[model samples]
Every structure is written in structure tokens, then in C-alpha cells.
Target: MAYQDEITHMDRAELEALQLERLKKAVVYCYEKIPFYKENFDAVGFDPYALETFEDLRRAPFTTKQDMRDAYPYDLFALPKSEVKEIHMSSGTTGVATVSGYTENDLKVWGDCFARGIGYAGGDENDIVHVCYGYGLFTGGLGAHYGGLNAGAMTIPMSAGNTKRQIKVLQSMGSSIICCTPSYAMYIADTAIEMGLDPKKDFHLKAGIHGAEAWSNQFRANLEEKLDYKALDVYGLTEVMGPGVAIECMEQTGLHVAEDHFWIEILDPETHEPVPDGEWGELVITTLTKEATPVIRYRTKDITRIIPGECACGRTHRRIDRLHGRTDDMMIIRGVNVFPRQIENVCTGFEEIADWYQIELTRENSLDVATLKIEINPDFPMDEIRKIEDLQRRLEQALKDELATKIKVKVVEPYTITRSEGKAVRIVDLRSEEEK
Candidate 1:
């Protein structure tokens, strides 16, 4: 059931040697072809040829999202436009979009990585993969589609939206595998119930591949219970070839990085220095085998630490713990820092609430105020206003205890919160608009 056993199960020493060789070549490629990398290397007084040991990589400057935007569409591409076969861009919610280009060979590498991930999640050619991730500009749909095809499975490009039809397909089409954002999967489960279809008994799904957003273990338990399948987390971004950068095997211990293709490092966000294994820090990646656009020392801003030991699945590639939170996504409210995932953990811990919630921050009298709007389960005692009020009071108290700050907790009826077919919008800060 293993894909590319030679590379996946290679000895740790051999893998490191391979990574070092590829790292050197990537450095030389970027320096020679991309003006941005060339200037960066010059500024750092680094010689691409002198990068003998892995430690030497630290000399190169870090690549940021702003750097990608500054490079614009094609300035950072290593290969000519004729050689680039595919293009994708980031969501661009925060600022200008970061573009990524891929050659045919790069596409093959991406497919291989995803195939490996599919295998890790117990997929085979006999399974039907229902990809609900949005198609086109977003990488999730096509990434999952290509991987399913590469693994010899029939991929159903359902895309996103049209929830009722999605449920019908699950009942009639004989699909066994599902891929989408975690929030969307939960939404699907909820919608199916509204349609009078039992998610556990009516659907043919056996496993699900969920990512593109941070989710808590409590959410995972809820998802598994509702969907009647094992929910596996996959990690990737459009900037680094999407959805197959790392994935959870059946063991579910940690996400196994595709080290043969990507060289990963955990670095302190402030010091920009390498952190010890199992310590939380930003994830930095170097593309070893990418052709069209190879990025060196790309800081992901995702907070996670490397797991020290080999996975029980026997993959030599190191594992990364589930993301804690992104440095940029952390919110400062009334001088107290809070992460949306922290609120999610506390909300999902309760059984009376649905798996949907939104965090809103606003300015009142020059002070920041946080409000959490949660969706109550439809089956909960909605007829009793006093019970609902009591639950709201309990939620507010629980959030205060966890966040160490008073927060407004408002509970709404089922399906009140806006659901995302792609990445969920959990936080909405109104301070900027109010100030302006």
C-alpha cells in the first residue's frame, strides 16, 4: 500500500544526504535564474557554491509574503514562461496575491506527493474520491483530483456548493473518499442531517482528507462521529505546491513532511534562528526539486514543531505537530493575545453547541472588545429561553477562564453563522474601519 517505497522508507541518513544535495542545487538554480534570490545572496555575502553543509543555508535571507508580492507574477520564476505549465495564487486576503508557477515536471512531482498522501490515508485505486474543494484558482480541488487519478482512483470533481446534490451523490454515486476544508466537511454533515439523511448510515464515505484551516482534536472527534469515517489532516499551501506538503498516516501521530522534495526547518519567529526539535516555531521550507519557481528559506508563518521520532507507518520523513496558530493570525484584543483556534477548542469542547462559531473584534470607546457568536445545536432545548440564557452565561464564563479576558458570547440558532465552501472566515476585526 506504500507509494514510492524507495524514497518514502529510505534510511534517515540517506534521506538527509539526498536533501543536502538537492538543497545545494536549488540554491544555485535560484541564484542564477531569479534576480530576487541573486540580490538576496549578494546582500548576505553568500556564495551558492559554498553551501556545503545544511547549516550554511542559514546564511541566506528569509523569503516573506511581501517578497513574493514585490516579485509580482513572474519575476521569481526560475524557468522561462514557455516551460511553466500551471499557475496558482494565494487567497490574497491580507494583501496582494503571491503567485506560483509549475512546469510539467513540477506537476508530476506534485501529483506524486499527493498520491503518497492518498496512500498514507488508506486510499487505493478501487476507491472513488469525491473532491469538494473549490476548483480553478484554488489548488485544493485540482491537487486532490490529480493525486486521486495518479493513484488509479476515479476522482469526482464535485467542486463546492450545492449541498443537497452533494448528499445525493454520496448516497447514489458510490464515492468512498472525501476531500475538502474541515469546516466545509462539518457543514456538509450538518446539511445532510437537515435533508433527513443520516451522515453515518446513509453515506458511503469511509475516510476524509481535511485541511486548509486549523482544527482542534475535539472538532476531529465531532467530525469522525458525525461522518462515520476517519478524518485525516493534510497540510500545504498554493505557494509551495498545495495539499501534499505533509499528511497524516493512519497512525495520526503527526503530519509526515515530503522531505525528499521539500527541506523543512523550524525557526524562531523573532530570532530567525533554528529551534530544537519538538519546540514551537515558524515553518521554513526550501523547494529542492521544483523547476519553474524554486523558493529558498520561505517562511510559512505557521506555528508548529517537528516531531523527533519516526512514524509508526515506517516513513523516514520527519513529522510536524498540528499547527498551534499562525503568528500573523494572532489577535491582540485589549492587550491580551488570542488565537481563533483557542476559542474553537473551547467551543468544540461543549456538546450543546454546533461546530460553527465566529470571532469578532471591535473598538468601543477606544478599547478593543471581543465577541464570539456560536451556533447552537438544533436539537438543544431551544424552547426554553432560560436554558439558552444559562448556556450563554456558561459559555461566556468558560471563554473568560480560557482567554483570561471578558468576551461577549452570543448563541444563535442552527445555520445562522455563514459557512465557507473554501477556507472559513473565523475572525472579523472592525477596529480598522472604525478608526478610519
Candidate 2:
């Protein structure tokens, strides 16, 4: 691993010691430099000065995403603009953009974090790194680009779109490490086949680091089989320095948290209290080393849990399970909470359906309606109308078994649904303003 052994191989005691040491300084700095933190802490009667251990740190008030969005462009920044070297932000598809700034050192830390992630995914100097995530304000492309360069690999800044050109580069350049959103990777695999190129034989892809959207284990397995490469899951958000928070190693069990830079706690979603080590809960993170726009106990709203056992790859920094879904991603259907990931799990189980899918939501006659839209596998015998109808029936039944609610399933022709260059849209809510 590139520049990784020092922290990656640290034992539990050593890693926790580093986390404790940094946690103290991070809280004090946030309280002193960011007035928002100061006011939040003061309002809860939580004194940063009294912080001594993990227990005390938990006493600190939770920092929600709304807190950061409410802060807006630069209000959450801990330093003056003169010191901020770069700025990046979320796409704000859910709401207003949450701004994040970085100092020179912060950028270096970001590079190091992603370099370690790249190494975990088996990226090396001998491999050509192809980064396909969108660039500029979004952190996916640039962060992976930094990590590729930092790892001393020949990095290609593809920055999404132009599928034919992307395939040309993949074949001609012999790129070995591909970084992009999971949905884009799936699209690329489909496109390669449509272009009559065997994904396993034509391209030189050895591994992929896919993130930026939630995908099920079924999706990853199907993707790996299609591309004949290791599909590693890398997790992050713009607020937490992007694409570098947790990275799945070749072992494929779970993602190792960057414990030296982050302190994570899994708390129950409804109660907001720490759960047992192996229980599912919301992931709350504290930026232990970030300088420019640090957040303490930021509620990620991501649903995951700590894996109980040790990873086979020997990375001692604790692993968290791949996210099932975000709390914000949940929707109520027929008195049951339905998540996009649950739909994905059910849809991907069938070989007749393509990986691409979407859910259409609307309100009709004072009742909510949700429809699952999936594309048929192009190679499947679509001329068999009976088979198509049978597939749809099975899908509806499987969905009801999984979601405990009947979700209308409609199978469309191949390539009917839009392909994504970045994070794929899972839900298309067409509810009227009055209905909402």
C-alpha cells in the first residue's frame, strides 16, 4: 500500500490512542475557530475543555447536515479565506450546496487518504489509473485524480461521459485501475458489450474503486462477473473530504475507516444513542484532522454497522459494513419504509433484467403509488412475449416478498432508460406540490 503501513497496520490500542489524541485537539480547534461550533457546544452546555475520552466526546451535540447547509458558503469555515487553498461542494441534488474548503495541508491529507484507498484497491505505479467521476466542484474525479498521481500511477482524468471515447482509452491505453460511480461502471460494461467488445478480454482493467451512490452486494457481484475484475467499494462525501473516508480492500468483507483522521460512532437512527458493536445504526463522524471546514459529530445519515471480526487483509483500523441505505433515502409505501437499496437487491436478483432501474413515485386518488421501471437485458429473448410477462410477474412477487408491499414492476425495452455518467437517479418523484 502506498504510504499506508504506518497507520493501516496499527493495532487497536495504537489506532485508538492516535484517535483520542487528535479528537481532543480537533474539538478545541473547532470550538475556538468556528463560531458555529462554539455556539452549538455552548447551547448544549458541553465544554470542549472537559473532553478527555470517547465517552466525553459522545456527550458533544450532534452536527446534522442541515447545520452545515444552514452555514452555507463559508460560515462553517474554521479559517480565513486567505488560508483556504481550494473549495469543493456537494451537487446539492437533495437541497442547498454544503461548502467545504481545504488548506494546502488539508489537500495533502486528502491525497494521502485516497492514495491509501487506491493502494487498497491494488493500484500501483505499473497500473494506469482512469478516473471517470465528474470533475470541478464534485470531489469524486479530482480526489481520485490526486490519489492516482500521489500513488505515482499514470492517471487519466476522463471526468465522465463520452462512452465511446472512454472505451477507446480503456483499450488503447491499457488502463488497469478504473475509478467511477458504480452505476457508471455498470453502464460502461453494458456499452462495451453493445459495442461487441468482450469486457473480460478487450480491456486491461484489473480493479475498480466505485462509490458516490449506494449499491447492494448483489450489484457488486454482478458487476465483478460482468467486467471480470475486483469491484472495490470506496465511501465518502464532500463534507468529509470525499471519496476517502472508508475503502474496501481486496478481501471484500467491509471498508476500513480512516481512523487516524476520523472518529466514527454508530448510533440508533430513532433514539440517537450508540448501538452495540455489531448492530446497524446511523454513522456519525468527527473530523479529527481536517482544518478548513471541520465538523464534529456530523450525522452522516448513512445506514451501516461495525463488522465484529477482523479483516483478512490485516488492516487493523476497524471495518464498517457497506451502507444499506441512507435514512434520507427511505420512503413510506403502504405503511412500510422502503429504500432504494431494497429495491435494487430484489431487481438485481434476476438475470433477465438489466442493471439499470428507477422508481417513479406519484399520488393518485389520495393514495401514493410507486412503480419500478427496469430495462430488459438486451441479449434476452424479448420476442418471447410470454417470457416477458412471466418475468414481470416474478419480479412483482419477489418485490412484495422483500418489501412487504406490492410495487408495480414494468419491464421496458433495453436502452430505454437513461444511462448515467455519474450518480444514477434511483427515484423520480412526480408527486404534485399539493400531494407533497
Cα lDDT over the full model 2: 0.90
The candidate maximizing lDDT is: 2
Worst 10 residues of 1 by lDDT: 427-436
Candidate 2 segments whose C-alpha is farther than 4 A from its true place: none
TM-score of 2: 0.97
TM-score of each: 0.97, 0.97
Q: Model 2 shows how many backbone clashes?
A: 0
Pairs that collide, model 1 = none
Per-residue lDDT over 1-436 for candidate 2, one digit per residue giving the tens place of the 0 to 100 score: 4557678989899889889999999999999999998998999999999898998987799888888899999999999999999999987877999989999998988888888888897777887999999999999999999889888899999999998899999989999999999999998998898899998999889899999998888888888998899999999998889988999999999998999999999999999889998899999999999999999999999999999988998889899999989898798887789989889888877989987889999887787788999999888988899999999999999999988997988899998899889989999999988897
lDDT of each: 0.89, 0.90
Error of 2 at 395 (Å): 1.6
Reference-based lDDT, residue 325, model 2:
91
* lDDT, residue 320, candidate 1: 97
